[model samples]
Target chain A: MGVPDPADAELVRRARNGEKVAFEEIVRRHGPAMYRFGLRMLRDEHAVRDCVQEAFASAWEALDQYRGDAAVKTWLFSILANKVRRYLRSQARSVPTEIDEGVIHSPAQHEPERRAIAGTMMAALEEALDELPLAQRACWILYEVEGLSYRRIAQIQGMSVDAVRGAIYRARQGLERRLEAWR
Target chain B: MEMSPERDLGPPSDLLARAAGELRQLTDDGWVRAEQGVLDRVARALRSARPVRGRHEGGDFFLSSTVLCAQVGTRVDLIPGVRASSVRIVTDDVDHLDAVTLTVSVAYGQAIADVGSRARGEAAAAATAALGVQVRTDQVTVDVLVEDVFVDEARDDGGADDAGED
Candidate 1:
């Protein structure tokens, strides 16, 4: 469902021509979404911001090499994903490979009666998302929240399209099972 | 590899669709504010980097084009009764023959020709001063948009009295 952004393309062109403001405009447009993606992946607010900063710096350095083969957002996401992965690896933080069943089953606490259902469902969803493996979580977020196609997700994650589809499928099933009460 | 059954793969599309809708509602207001800090860092980094390449004083020095555009745009913006929408610079093979195209919206009751000329002069001057190179006046093109007049400020000042009288 994503369409090409003509304004972004023009800004990219100007940035390539050494327009700082144009590049800054590009940063303003995509930075928030990139930060959100990084936060979802790393789950560390500070780390995510640092990773996004590094990603944009790297993108600027490599601006001339960008051929526009993919949308700028896709390109930026790929860079941020890789940066987050590298940071996680360097920190030696163990990413849980298995989904935590306990989190899935825990009942929402202190929820208001009026919006109990929606609040409980949302809480369950967040817990289920947090329990997913990094790869699957990234796939789900990109495909579901970001509205990226399977092909774009595959490219960003450096996997085959079928692999991306499989990851999304697994993530969806896990969430569905966890939030079956809401359904 | 053997294929799994469709049932084993995931939930039905409708269920996943509902989940996606609910998840999209989540927001992080803090991250929105944090983005400005990241942008500031980016702007500083870009400012320090060399952005333009040209021959200066028989030697060569680089100027950041981002800085150059901002300077040009700022100058054009400083002119009352007009706002610079976009500024783009194109250089020929020698890099000395620089051409600038500026898109601007002129306020109503302002002469388009005068605003265009002033924007052109200001942009060229700003580029010359910032780039340390003489930018030719003839190479600048001001693309004027007469439709984008700011009526709110005019209305507050009673400046649109003539239009109101009609």
Candidate 2:
């Protein structure tokens, strides 16, 4: 259905004041976004759901620690990134194969040629993505697909903004290198 | 069906692109549901045990975790694709007609030998009886701690799986 008014600040205020209903409201308002963040990072729905839940749980506990230096979305996104990193650490040894689930509508307006090429290109891009280091993968997905800003990415990842830029740059170069052979 | 040439020939570029396209598909329901259930149980326990946090600074640390042990036991062993020689429930508490610790025994080398020491029996239980009591699975090598007896009476709510071991 529809969401309530954008009252994250108010809700967070209530939540900090110990209103679980307010907290629940915040969860309802932001759950989808948080879920999307986890989905992009984990690529495994199970792991994504887990990371989302963990991020929420940790945020609930750590909300008191929030200094209000950033927006609620940025804060929540930061927590989700930490959760994702911790998950990767625990399962670092194993190969994580993420199965994505979204309907890919072919390029609608014009550009059938690019669509054909892009479709083929998308496959190679994904393989390279899967093969890419987790840091690089997170940077690429967050930077290109999600369109998050570098500072936001850094906040999410608990790193310097410059580090985020470096990661994104490295990721872009990797994708470009992979696509070069196709060109 | 007009299959893409990439699918058939599998060039490095075609392979990579196809893999990328397929990489976004989401499939993992069972795992999510199971973990959700575990977290729910955990949340409840954390809430219930918060009251006793100050009361049991040291001695109560072990007592506060009774229900947690059960929760972990259920999660770790209940999942599919696990095998065990046995799951031994080890605890010093030995005086109960029912509601015995759901003891499980693992074969040797399953966990460190020193872990056996943490499986001591105490009059400890969760502050909120409903949450039950449990300890850290990773911290302890409890295959199971079947309760054969206890000095005090436990809740008679018939709340859980009460396997009476003679």
Candidate 3:
């Protein structure tokens, strides 16, 4: 019911009942967004894609846990978010935080404000987003962009509403600081 | 237990918001494909999960054997508690049913004679015909195990089988 299509419920039912077609629909519908969302958060193309795939695989196995209360999209994002967190934890050991100034703050930052379009101007925003602590970035994405309520966002991020609010505030502050000139 | 219902509006950048929207669409579409793929796989899995009968074929022959069981067994009874969900024919040894004695499981309350039992025989005959096997009815020894018993007072009253009734 939470999803736009009753077909989603039917798909969920079939998936729960072991229908492969239904499962495929779920994957196809969510896979690209999953990768992109994970990519935006994780910033490593390979790691983000892996996390997205891992999340779908995990959701496939535990599909019965989908109560239809939250949209399957929401449930999947939660899974993806968890995978990203785990990835971050693993990477914390091998590679210290190193910002890719070339891919991000390259000579491209020289463009004037009037030409400051989302297509180009958001590179620093993206870098700043990528640079954020994973939790804060997740909060910002779910809250300000995805338009999910703070409560649901909190559930996905494994943080309290107050903490989520703080994360969003901090994420916003971080973004504004990086793009202060554009404002 | 550590779960909470906390929420957030995400990062306050409008461009990022738009990007996330576009990203969500992309993810949703991709997942639709993934779901379809998984659904196909799951359907294949479930279909394969059906109970396979015998080393080769002749699953339907079991029903024919059941019929033969009903004919030869001392007890005139019916199967109970279920219906004929599905029936299929498979390969069998040419003389598989020749003097083969087996117990037949059928339900009483859940199956009607003309529907379940009769249909079962019909299916078995079809299967036998399909296999090019002419079931003579004499070559098979089927013992119907009457697991359920009930009084059909109409038959017990003998109003129909009574030869005296013109």
Candidate 4:
């Protein structure tokens, strides 16, 4: 077998010591998930790209200060979350619930009828998610879609475990009411 | 059956489940291009960014701590069984190189003491070459701290044994 890949902690340790390649390897490994998270949170193609890029740039600059208290993935998500918040503050505008053409298209788009329905459902869900308070949206996405644990979400959100639980609970209620038509 | 507005979160309903799945599968036309863009930008920034600098002007010349630590780090990494994680060069008030500290990780089963000695020697040599000052006259000090041990997977014999150490 080929040489085993280095652990994330190992890469972080190497990165702390001024190894560019180690950090780049980290970017390659985690960049896709980060992209997905950004797309779901920000919903704007340009905004997602910018947030992911800036998150990584900030991560590289702050590598020395990383204490490894949290998993590298958790830490990265935290940084990306902060960047997303900063982007939102700088804009100070309403969260756009509209689905862009570039966001997603059904793989089975050949069926016109099915594609239209799928598009509607996707847009509806996006709208429902967008209606949530930013904190609830972030907490819900991280917990449900990303499958991160409560503790991990708490660390990323800088909230207590109980607080994260409450946010997620409220998020579920909001989504359920918003999407009740699908029931 | 009536539904209560105040209800505990249950397992995701069918719609919510599908929505979550769709979120997980999100992709865009520009995803691949954007990811490459980020990597390229980060790599370029790293190459051009000057992280920290220590400049000391002697009678006729100046020395940079950033360059000094980088050179020292390279030298330390060249030693057989150790990889330098961080290299620091401390400059005195007059900008003379005062001390160097090297944090390193050693390969599993390697001799820690030997690795530390070689790392110190290489670091000192590199600093002297960079600063144009003799170790004795400048009183350059080198400290080597072995902070971790890593398995040499390339050298492994491909055994089925897993010892749970990285």
Candidate 5:
């Protein structure tokens, strides 16, 4: 755990006091990351946008119940994780179909050498991520990419800490095997 | 045959870092364009999800706080010598539209008192026109933001000079 962000706390306070702008600020601050998480989970841009919207709306309606126990980011991510799961279930899909290479745009497109290396590595990693089971992938992303602790990931995923760890461990092993060529 | 210890796999730290970086890049690119759209969608969804405020004698009715905030925000922005950087409306009772508190920010260097009064009057008028309800001036509070003082002051001073030459 880290120090609570005062700005986020203040925003949350004002939002709770019925300030629409404060709540909008909260959505703006966290919306992009939530969108990214949705894209990674669902791999559909439209679906990602819908999921992020649903999650924020849900958060806003339930703001009164938010106890401030978790960081606002974590709270939002938790809501988003639930939204993604519900979306997946609603679609009657088990695994996300394929990695959309179009989603991974190079930040420096003109730098040929860096672009080639990053593109290849990113493609490989996306494949590896796709290969992971949904649970393992969720845990891996929350822990490794989002820098959440195993306990926090467990809370978000509704599992034990050990289970989160095991899932992450398996995900890492699978990815390492799939990405050995890059090393 | 069992795999050799030397070949045992581990976490792909470097790959993970690179992937995180790539994912961030992808998100950053999309976000710049999608931010306002996303907020609008979220705002719409939230407003729709709220309970209906019940029927008036005229017909069925529901008032969206989001819409009201936007109206007030627009009215404040249209005021001379002031730009509404942010507008926040606190509704104590969403169903009745009573005890509403409007908080707003105006561009700096203008007469704060005059701007505040005008903003309150305009917002109240806009809300009454839009919602068919009286929004009293006492319900609005204004905060003057000094952060944009330099730019606003420059624009104000330069606008007249440029206009005279033209």
Candidate 6:
């Protein structure tokens, strides 16, 4: 068997002491998750990529100040939430956004019938998500899609846990209404 | 008391629940396609943020303690039965070298003293090579603290003594 990699706490300890390779390990572990998060939050391909890159850059610069009070992934999402909000503020964009369909690839593509169904459902879900307010969508994605705990999502969004639950509840209701055809 | 919407969140709909799972899969696929490009951009951005403070070697030259610690960590990790968890370089006033502390975890069944001594020697050599400022290996004060002893699960020999596994 291959040697087991060190835990995140160990990596963070090394990174705090100025190990670029350790920090790189962190990026490798969390980058994909952050990318998925960015895509869910910002439908545009370029914007999502930029958000993930900027979040990592900020994290690397602030490694010295990280106190490890929260999970590394949670801290990363907090930084990413700040970057996304800043980007949104600069653009002042409207809701009901359109995603770049070309970037989406479904794992069910091998089965043609399954692919068609998944494609339709995914399109509907994306539209439903796009219609949600940014905060509601973010709360829903972080809690539902990313499987983050409500407390962790609250930490990332700087809101009360009750507020996160409320947002998720409303988002779920809206999604249920919009995607009723698929059920 | 009024029932808050949050508290009244009924059983999640099967369609939305399935949609959430599918969204996770969809986003994961997209991320795989763009992962390399994103990481490359991140690496490029961090290049300019290297540590700035350093000990003046001489004649406008300096050696960063951060750099030294990284090197020490790399070298110490190469030793069998030991893994470096943290490496720190201490400098005195006037920016002179003070001591190097390496916290490491030793594999179960390996002699703790032996691993620590080997790590100390490697750290001193690494610091000397990294600075290259006429400092001898013997002049470097190296401390290796055994913060943990871990089971080398691959080599599970049961006759071990004093594993001190943490």
lDDT of 4 at A162: 65
Model 3 off-target regions past 4 Å? Answer: A1-5, A95-119, B1-166
lDDT of 2 at A63: 54
* CAPRI accuracy category, model 4: incorrect
Query: Which interface RMSD does candidate 4 score?
Result: 9.7
- Stronger candidate by lDDT (5 vs 6): 6
- Model 2, residue B116: distance off in Å is 49
Overall lDDT per candidate, in order of appearance: 0.67, 0.47, 0.51, 0.70, 0.63, 0.71
User: Can you write out model 5's per-residue Cα lDDT over A35-120, one digit (the tens) per residue?
Assistant: 77776677666677777877888887666546454678878888888887777665554336653332322122223323454557
Best by lDDT: 6
Q: Which candidate number has the best TM-score?
A: 4
DockQ, structure candidate 2: 0.03
Better of 3 and 6 by DockQ: 6
lDDT tens digits by residue: candidate 6, B1-166: 3235655355467887888887777766666666777667656654222232333445534566656666778788789888787677777666666778888988988999999989998888887676655344467568889988877745874322221111
Name the runs in model 4 displaced over 4 angstroms: A1-6, A93-118, B1-10, B28-30, B47-90, B93-166
Question: What digit string (tens of lDDT, one per residue) describes model 5 on residues B83-158?
Answer: 5544444444646554334444445566777776777678778767666655565553433332233236435533
RMSD of each: 15.9, 18.5, 18.4, 11.3, 17.2, 12.2
lDDT of 3 at A53: 64
Most DockQ-accurate candidate: 6
Q: Candidate 5, TM-score vs. the true structure? A: 0.56
Ranked by TM-score, top first: 4, 6, 1, 5, 3, 2
Worst 10 residues of 2 chain A by lDDT: A101-110
lDDT of 5: 0.63
Clashing pairs in 5: none
Which segments of model 2 are wrong by more than 4 Å?
A1-6, A93-123, A179-183, B1-166
> Per-residue lDDT tens digits of candidate 3, residues B6-108?
4423334664555455445433433443444444443433221222122225343223332232232212223233222222222246525443222233443
Clashes (N, CA, C under 3 Å) per candidate: 3, 49, 68, 1, 0, 0
Candidate 4 lDDT: 0.70
lDDT over C-alpha atoms for residue B117 of model 4: 86
